[model samples]
Target: MSGTLALVPAAPGKRLGAAVLDWLAPVAILTVLLSFGFAGITSTRSAGLIIYDTSLLALLGSIGAGLALVYAFAVATVEGRSGNTIGNRLMGIRSADKDGYAPGLGAVFLRGIVTGAGILLAVLASVLVAVFKWFDAAPLILGPLLLLGTAWAAVVVVSSAWDRNGKLRGWHDRAAKTLVFDVVNGRNPVATGGIEGPYSFAPLDLPPVQHVASPVASRTPVVPGPVASETPVEPLPPAAHAVHLDTAAHPETAAHPDDAMDRTQVRAGVRQDAPEAVLRITLDDGRDFRLERTVLIGRNPAPAAGESQAQLLPVPDPGRTISKTHLHLLTDGTGLWVTDRHSTNGSAVTTPDGMRTALQPGVPAYVSPGTTVHFGDRTFNVGHA
Candidate 1:
């Protein structure tokens, strides 16, 4: 590839945030159910005081244990099917295999089980010990088990950061052979070599032109013939000659119409013998949109009177962060060119070298493969098919 390979790792803070969100819903549901059940069991004593019984405490312990098990199973099932939990989807990150494809349901399930079962078991054990007052009787065993469980949980949380390859692989990821990537800027997993690499133009494979020379003995002696008078042709100007030489050297350039010449197409057409390049943009939500000659991007765009054309890409922006007509992408030959349409939040382009430049409205920017473009809070990367 023209640029070095860079894996887009989801920030540790975002990962933690997603995990918290994922757990919140189940915890809230369990807490509400337990609260209502406990209210019915508690007995009102003299002076409006409430008395709790051992049975209520035991029920609380059972509820906690049951919730833990349910949470683990639910998370695993969801993640296995979609490679994302509710939190991960909200944070624009997802799990994938090493090559960038979605880690199948089996892998995701295994990861969820490995990372969650131990922690849930520990929590369940802690609840049982606390409710039954067994910790005081077996402090040695209970204390050690609690500590080990806490340590395991902590290790899983930070394991991705500890990976030597910077692939953002946690213990669950390693166990399942999965990797977490920021969907916005991650490299395409299925593309050949991940991205299109730099290549030089070579001569087309054509049969060698054969020139047959006349044998000297077979040549006829020159016989004078009547000369025919005609107007002498003038030589072409220097500029015209130069243009001719250029067209001859790059035959693909001659095929494109004059009006079709653009920076993106010109560069892409340089290698005429190479396969036609395709442009693909992958969204943070695991959606891939292939760009045609013209692409319109925005949250939504209303159709005006007498305008029958529908928007090319009408993305749903629940936060109202993206503009109605944020930007436009055009396929210039094999490459892509993006132009901001005076968006309210503006837009930015991140080059392959990690440098970001704010885009000016109406000015087109060539987006190379592996480069990312950000529009408001959303982002997409340009890649080859």
Candidate 2:
């Protein structure tokens, strides 16, 4: 329900790619552990031994449980601190809240719990089957339960592609209200404009250009003159002064009246006559930011102990949707341009004419006056101030 939900979501392809990598990592680790354990057990087995030792079975069980817990804890810790796991980092994506801010540790924990729920269920079912194996009827029920747990986990992951909002969110993400966005495109969703509702604009019509004839030409008299043969003209006498008619002296012959006063002062390659054109970005909460030169917009990076705050413009993004350095804004006397600094959520521009365009990463786009620039959910209006 927060305004941050308006922020752009990550692509589904990236989400699935990252998820596969993350899931495979733990599986790889567990496989290695199992392999080593299997080799040790194989070496200790005797031809005369009809049954395996209970201690070995217990050790194997312990290893399985430990691996599962380790996988869950590792993912939770990594995401809680920086919203990036091995898979997320590799895929150039990270998780955040709808507001494009970092979800707190609690949310990360919840997400991890939900993500690992299926695995945990399968493990529980296995434990139950092993403990109750003395009862011949137990496997019949526990086996189906284990299959169900595995199915549920698959459903959880596959369901991510089914998000109606196209956020590519899984049950874990929905439970935690978290979103995954590309590393170079994610931005603070809450701070972007137009979250309250649809914006209504009146039709804008510019006056048509008019070309009028000069009053002098209209009033000039037309006289018929006799055709004469081409003849050499004599030069004027030195005593006869030449008359030069100045347009300023004869208003009737002047073209545009305001042309004389329209001159602008040029300083250091910039025009200084008119008020400096600036982009005034006003947040939905009434906070505003003025972009003059170049500004780095994003969430503040984690500061070191006793370190002063960064010089960058920090937007409040509790969802962790905005990158530490989202994008760069550059402005001149003519217009403003925005460049995506390889953020996770990407940036966009909405023109006054109601056209929305996505900006390419590392590419700078000119923002027309009265246009809205969106960085995730955060938005700012660009215009002459």
Candidate 3:
């Protein structure tokens, strides 16, 4: 990768705002139900007092309580499965685990229970007080406690403002073992790595690792020559001129005649047999690759079933901005086709004429030799090698 995929912590203000939004739907539902129920109360004031439709209020309140639980469950499920609730999406933030993945249903549910304990308990208290007439005076004791818990829940969510870790992890986050992420301005983890490092991938029928060698290795076998092969050898493509070259000026001559010829063949195979590549791709990190036919480019890519002929081009991306199999690059003698591999950050190409177009996922777009293809935090220029 050329630059870093910097992760920005979700700000305290944003988290608190999201929390409020996350709870808004259920709160609004319960409030509306309770308000309508209370408004329907009938009264007889002749005895200097009023009599209310207690049974009807209790029924509506109980219904509201049930609906609240359902709403809570729905919100938690959405957040757990996708790492975003309506509120989190609006705040441009999401909750994730340490490795930057969505915390599962259990964690997200536990977090909701802990963070929303106050309001939930208050609702339960009301339900209990209404369900049992014997607890008619229960509000005298429950009211203060419920109010205090509500204030405390607010404090717990806002406590992230004082978090020293800088990720705004509050008590609820700790209980859930989750961290909130800034998605709008930071790296978004939609796909895990399949090349290397700690990541899981679905079973893909991939070929052996033979293709990981240099591009030239496919057409011409490359023997692993020692680093000491710095001894100058004549750049002869054929053996007709190899025998007449200087024997003393080159180190391979000190050996037997056959050994000299063998070293010459090894040197020629190692450095001189590279085929003329149709497109030379220079990655942002300064490493270049010679694209001949089909090549899979990603953080760690492999040739799946139909792609047996393609080469695996592994890109070192610690931040995981690039997906496991990010893009598919296929080149003819004079044409190039780039297909985005359902990547998270998406891919694009800027032509030599300065026009930029975003590539749709799984669709191959034809680009000229001067076009530069950008995938995630990295880019490569397409040219003749």
Candidate 4:
């Protein structure tokens, strides 16, 4: 509830700057290559082929325009919508729905199609005018007009940054109800807004939307796997990788082997039933914690010292002892463990080296199989079914 207020507004100017940089690089490179090409054409005369002509300049112009279109559409629409493209990513900008969720693939495809079409149309118009001049013997005005129009369109696309809300606008942004915003510190929570003008509506406090490194629940069903639910759950970081412990068949199963497949096999073959509980922890990494099979241990029923002592989840299950302080236990056939659901005294974890660390209420601790977990002097060893 109490935190600093910062707005992650979109930087339309930065994005446009990046695009212009990208556009110029290729043009410079192509000009160099074309210069060489033109020299070769003049230096060597070949009867077998139609030698170089001023018309070739028109061909080069078309090629340049086509390249520009492909670059813009692909980078802006496809990459921008899904993951920030090279330009946007380098510029520290991201795109999302008016509500602040990731944009759908449809948005990406639409942007690509429209932007690409615009680029090509502009170039084709220029080419047609040139051809007309040759045939009709008219003044050479149409070509410049087409070029100017195309450049103006580019300007429009880039100017979306100037919108009051700091959101980008394009064909896809309008159709898919999305916009781009800067993810200052990677802490986007929710999306809320409207779609008007070019950019989508901005949320009151535009937090940087965080992304899950691992796959979460989603609407589209993957071929064979878990569907990511829409809940705001962040993936566990590698540092927090729970050391696999088992409490199934034996009290002491050897530590996991190097081979992942071998470890999976060993875990599947052992381990036992675990306690049932769900504690939601909102971590500093902007992820919601959903833990199961954890046991809270305390005698006085108040959170004990060094045990998770804050926001202890109230269990509704009638079978278990009901109290303000509870222990959650989970067994993966290997080890039974508990995590502190924010208790007052804090959850204390016994390290393998025989040292105990206070598991703060918001933090989680792993209790190895058969390891004596002491919470408020109430010692309990992991048990199997």
Candidate 5:
């Protein structure tokens, strides 16, 4: 871990919410695509004997529009919820302001717009190029839009990779002054800290106030009383013998200093600071694991070429290279999930049959986010950064 301090903008495990939202996006897109495809096919069939080429083009355009809407919704929702879109999730990417937070809807919308514009421009450019090729004359004017779209896409990608956090600062996060925590361990640091030590107060005595007399009054000394005949004072009785106290007399007091310390401080300290384990997931091979930090949830090793703020961390101690031992983090458009990337350990899952059932390595298990993941002697969890 780098010694440089990584400011924790928000409590840890915030990205899990956005991950859930991202997971839902693909399902939503799939629904939209299938519906649109079916509808387009039906409409074209109903208008049979018409210009087949134009009809096909119209259907293609409709599909393109549907795709654009999916992109817009996916990006907008993720940006709104967490400051990045589904593309960011799938690509292990994110976008945020200089300071991380959930960027406002406006920033999300603006990012969506920028993304949409780029796609639109790309499509337009491709069409223009096709036209120019067909005409064999002066190239179409849409070439510039194509170039602009390409440039915009490149810029966004680069900005994300190069930014302080692995994020593309969109209008929403920027306007809202929020940033994104790209890789989250899914455990709440505040909760962790609370489990460790919460703010508390105790009472202690303060010094008493002082008093003074008037200088004149103090200056005048009183005359001593007339001397009286001195009588020999009788010696006091022999000092009382030391008394032993019974245990019952001091039930509240401890028998030893260490015991006192343990009662007063050790017990209180345990109540103050202690490590908390969140969730435990069992793999197919009867091996149970705990969540940890600095984990890679996505399969991809890199972001787009121009992704500016995209941060990359090398896999530390790729342990136990089992047959089905790879792992990936995935967002189900609502929450985050840690999944086995088809490792040879057989990705065992604890089944209701009270036995470990081997699942496909690529399958996912709902390991708690921000939770420390413990695997054999190794542990993975997110910390500051």
Candidate 6:
């Protein structure tokens, strides 16, 4: 599980939507074929029984059927290689095997066989009418078959709704050992970022700001006055104490008068020049960065409000593996927090002990030193500088 990212299951609606789009070409072909076949049948109602052998309508129907066959093969080939079809891309979703890769030709063909059973049933009936039956299959039989086939196909599309494993696999998906994922909200195995359009983005969840009311009513004003000769001062803060020499408080230091520094100056210096801890980001691409302020890192990262002047680390990726604004990294004295910028392939953090957790888009998560952060195909190790 070195770089594994869990895929979120696609919704039933999205699955149905993709199926509808996938079915379009085949459906159109079938519709044209049936119409031509039916026309051929009606025309030869009073003609000789061998009319189909020379009928123009029968010839057109045969051509349409051939197109349908070709369409299926084309779709299977594309999906086998990319795990996406025309509809899957538009819906911002895809089908993949357990390792989140294209399931290959065998699985894709198997899936097509299972999911297309109903559609092919209607096509077969049309072929029988156009060829053997000489377009003589009754409308009563054809109508009901077509209707049943349509309904069955639709059922197959949304069958994942009834899946037992949290509705993650449809019947065809299970048969092919593939899984459908909501790429609009999760990692896209193919790329790190892109609005695979026709699908809405998930709503951004910003951290809620909690406002604490100041106790103004109970506060008292201090008057300007001369201090008593032996005025009692407030105890020094831990940081101030660490930076100062208080001989009066620690009599043992009185022997070294030369070591005495002005306590007030020391306290003031600590307050003004407190050191902050920053991070060193070491990329797998052999780039090392140690920036003090907020940073945006990606292929072509740009800053946002308040960070308009922030550091931009343009990753050297000719393949565009990372998003335009893949990650937002901020360092305070205490630690570092990273935010995923809604990249398509998503991002994740891996602990020193090898615990991997996916990062939610726009959500900040604290990372410890010696851990690795991954975005797209690139990975970077975080460490204290």
lDDT of 4: 0.46
Rank ordering of all candidates by TM-score, starting from the highest: 3, 6, 2, 1, 4, 5
Compose the digit string of candidate 4's lDDT tens values, residues 319-385.
Answer: 1122245455544545554665433223465655677776665455565543545443234444332
Error of 6 at 248 (Å): 66
TM-score pick, better of 1 and 4 = 1
TM-score of each: 0.39, 0.42, 0.51, 0.37, 0.31, 0.47
Compared to the true structure, candidate 5 yields what TM-score?
0.31
Model 6 scores a TM of 0.47
Candidate 3 lDDT by residue in tens digits, 1-385: 1123345668778887897887767777777777676556565666786555576676787788888888878887877766888888899987876556666789988887787788777766766665654244654856676677668778877777777776458888888888787778865443332112122221234342232433533466455555666669876656746655655568665557555435535555465665754777877766668886898999789777899888888887654668779999888857699999877568999999999999999999999888899887679988776
For residues 282-353, could you state the per-residue lDDT of candidate 2 as single tens digits?
Answer: 554445555556666787643234424423577765344466777777777467778887565678888988
Q: Which stretches of candidate 5 lie over 4 Å from their true place?
A: 1-5, 8-53, 84-87, 90-99, 122-144, 160-178, 184-385
Best by lDDT: 3
lDDT of 1 by residue, 283-371 (tens): 66545666777778987854335434533787655434466778878786578889898664578999999999999998999888889
**Candidate 5 per-residue lDDT over residues 1-385, each given as its tens digit:** 1111222232222333343455356435543553454344322234454221234334654575667567657666656655446544554434444423344567666654554466566555545533333322313444466467555644543343444643334332354454444334221111121111111111123233233342333455454444444544354334412112444466675276444333321221235654553333332223333334323422133433453333332222222222122355543322336555533222333333344444455566653333443322233442211
Instruction: Mark the regions of model 3 whose C-alpha exceeds 4 Å error after superposition.
Output: 1-18, 21-26, 38-110, 123-149, 161-168, 180-213, 221-297, 300-313, 328-344, 360-371, 381-385
Q: After best superposition, candidate 4 residue 188: deviation in angstroms?
A: 5.6
By descending lDDT, how would the candidates be arranged? Answer: 3, 6, 1, 2, 4, 5
Candidate 1: global Cα-lDDT?
0.64
**57: Cα error in model 1, Å:** 3.5
Candidate 4 global Cα RMSD: 21.2
Query: Scored by CA lDDT, what does every candidate get?
Result: 0.64, 0.61, 0.72, 0.46, 0.40, 0.71
Q: Between candidates 2 and 5, which one is better according to lDDT?
A: 2
* Model 3, global lDDT: 0.72
- State in Å the error of residue 80, model 1: 1.2
Clashing pairs in 3: none
Question: When superposed on Cα atoms, how far off is each prediction in RMSD?
Answer: 18.6, 16.1, 13.0, 21.2, 22.1, 17.3
Cα error, candidate 1, residue 31 (Å): 7.3
**Candidate whose TM-score is highest:** 3
